[model samples]
Target: MVTDPRPGQILALVGWSGSGKTTLLERVIPLLTARGLIVSTLKHAHHAVDPDQPGKDSYRHRIAGATETMLATRERFVLFREHRSADEPDLALLLSRMAPADLYLAEGFKSAPVAKLEIHRPSLGKPPLWPDWPGIIAVVTDAALPACPLPTLDLADPGAVAGFIATRLGLR
Candidate 1:
């Protein structure tokens, strides 16, 4: 029962820790890519994280006051930018930096106004977020959900979830 999402749609997978958001993405990304869809992912972290290691050339360049560093190889390239201010960039601004893709799957930013699928596990002892989160279009859960406005999918089935996403993105 997936509806057509807007062009270049960005969907968010949101849930509490241990709810299996990342696990689901690992399953879903291949399904979409195998069908010739270019999928990009944006992950938001609440804590400070550095993808570059210390003592690396790129790390040294950044530490020496370089605003940005690009590490390139024949296979792939990575661009790292440093933000010195307290304010963080919004989702739209960050998205503009990414290369063109058919769909952008966001791993966090629960309140960013994008359509989202919430992962819920009863074992986590947390209430369902879709009850309060207006942007949540569906819920993927292990336990049965009460009567909700959004569609619910079983957490054990990644194929079904991937199909749902493909239909929603109009890739089917």
Candidate 2:
């Protein structure tokens, strides 16, 4: 399926560790938002991560076999749950749970259907992940890749990458 057009756009940033994907994304977010576009980020994690503290009621509920638990305060809230046997939810499910926004910036989930910008570092001893992944719309790399089918942006110029994204999504 294509990215949701309702909320504006969904952009993915994919790369190997230490290839500067996150750093570029971090820089791009503010620049995009400064132009009056709403933005949210989704980061894929391989390890168990709990934004809540241990021994808290919500944490205890999770450890006590509760399938789902929600904690709320005056202005904020969090929902926690554990999956028993089902596969982890995909991009659509995660996006569904988020508040509405003009754009969504996703990091990782390299295999998802979303259009992506891959960060490449030749010194990492790995070939470009682009040629095999046609969904990659662009590349941010220091090394030259002549036969690359995708547009190449300088890794040092975060603005250029952000501009490309804006152009691709037809955003200002």
Which candidate comes out best when scored by TM-score? 1
Q: Compared with the true structure, what per-residue lDDT tens digits does model 1 show for residues 60-124?
A: 99999999899999999999998888988677877888888888899988978788999999888
Tell me model 2's lDDT, rounded to 2 decimals: 0.85
In angstroms, how far off is 126's CA in candidate 1? 0.8
lDDT (10s digit) by residue, model 2, range 1-172: 5455454388889988889888898888998998888898999987777897889888888888998899999998888767876587788888887888878889988888888889998889887888787578899998888888778999888889888888888887
Question: lDDT (0-100) at residue 148 of candidate 1?
Answer: 70
For model 1, the superposed segments whose C-alpha errors exceed 4 Å read 1-8
Clashes per model (N, Cα, C within 3 A): 0, 0
In model 2, what lDDT does residue 107 have? 94
Which pairs in model 2 have colliding backbones?
A: none
Residue 15 alpha-carbon offset, candidate 2, angstroms: 1.2
lDDT, candidate 2, residue 64?
89
